[model samples]
Target: MIEYSTLKQTGRFIIILGIQILILNQIHLGGYITPFFYPLFILLLPFQTKGYVVLLLAFFTGLAVDMFSNSLGMHAAATLFMAFFRPGIIRLLSIKTEFEPEVEPRIHVMGKVWILTYTVMLIFIHHLSLFLIEVFRFYELGEILAKTIISAGFSVIIIMLTHFLMGSARKT
Candidate 1:
């Protein structure tokens, strides 16, 4: 039988992906900020999840977004890049004794400041990699920076809100 946590995680993954594909995909704010909260799925995984598993999940998640967005492999590439750096970022942000078994990197669990920092760094990396891959032009560096900053801001906000909502729901 499937474990409860596994079922919960699968449902959460489907919901996040559906929201990104169906809802977020349709919204284009000034054509500059395309929020991608799908990364939150990767961010909130259990702390003990294997590195290879994270990479695989990131690839498939971003591939799904690419399949819908038709941006080729930009999302997949960006997400994989972010996943590659996830362990390092976690180490930088955490003390050696910080994580307990089954703890996730959620706002309520890890506190607001830590979550904010974690989200900001990873989202910036994801957005920068994504925009760079999408444009593939160094001459347009200014525009790429503009899009990455603005879009990362929006994505971070949306992802934080998701954490707050989900964290509170778990509390009740």
Candidate 2:
């Protein structure tokens, strides 16, 4: 039988993925700045979550987005890269040497600066992988950089706003 926590996590992933594929894709604040929140779901996963499980979920999430957006494998590659790198990033940047099992990566647990830095770094990587793959050329490196930076910044703002408003700042 699936555990209750697994059920809850599945639901959360579905809702966030739906928002990304349906709502966020339709809204363009500009030509360059489109917010993606699906990464926030992965970012908030329990600190001790198994690596393979994270890779699987990130794969599914990216595949879902790719299906809806018809962007081929761009989302899949980027999200998978982010998932693969998540643990190292957390360990490298986090202040806490120890955490309770199932600790959620939130501002309350990781503090403002730590969480902010963590989120921005992953978002930048995801965006860079995505935009650079789409562009597929070094000549337009400047454009790729601009798009990645703009989209990542916009995504960070949206993620932070939601966390503060919903009190996702709390440790879970």
Candidate 3:
């Protein structure tokens, strides 16, 4: 039988992807900001999850979005890059303390500062890689940077809000 956590995560994966493809993908602020809170799905995975498993999940998650957005493999590539560095980032952030194998990188569980730093770093990496892949032009570096900064900022806010809402909802 499937574990409860497995089922829960599967449901969340579907929901987040649905929202990204159906709702958030439609929003483009000044053509510079498009929130991709879908990365939060990857960020929230359990610490014990194998690196290969995380990479596979990230690939499929981003591939799903790419299929909808028709941006080729930009999402998949960006997400893969982010997932590749997730473990190192976690280690860097928790240099003084060790996280439990099953502990997820959630704001309430990990504290605001840690979660903020974690989310910001990963989101920036994902955004920069994504925008760079999308543009693929050295001359447009400035525009890409602008988009990455603005989009990462917005994505971080949405991710934090989603975490708070999910955390509170789970309490009741």
Which consecutive 10 residues in model 3 have the weakest lDDT in total? 95-104
Candidate 1 residue spans exceeding 4 A from truth? none
lDDT of 2 by residue, 5-119 (tens): 7897889888888888889998888654678899988898889888899999888888888998889788899999899889889889865656776678877666788888999
Best-performing candidate as measured by TM-score: 1
Local error of candidate 2 at residue 53 (angstroms): 0.8
**Candidate 2 has which clashing residue pairs, if any?**
none
User: Candidate 2's error at 102, in angstroms?
Assistant: 1.4
CA lDDT, candidate 1, residue 39:
96
Candidate numbers sorted by TM-score from highest down: 1, 3, 2
lDDT of 3 at 7: 94
Q: Which runs of model 2 end up more than 4 angstroms from their true locations?
A: 168-172
lDDT value, residue 28 of candidate 1:
93
Clashes of each: 0, 0, 0
**Between which residue pairs do clashes occur in model 3?**
none
lDDT of each: 0.89, 0.84, 0.89
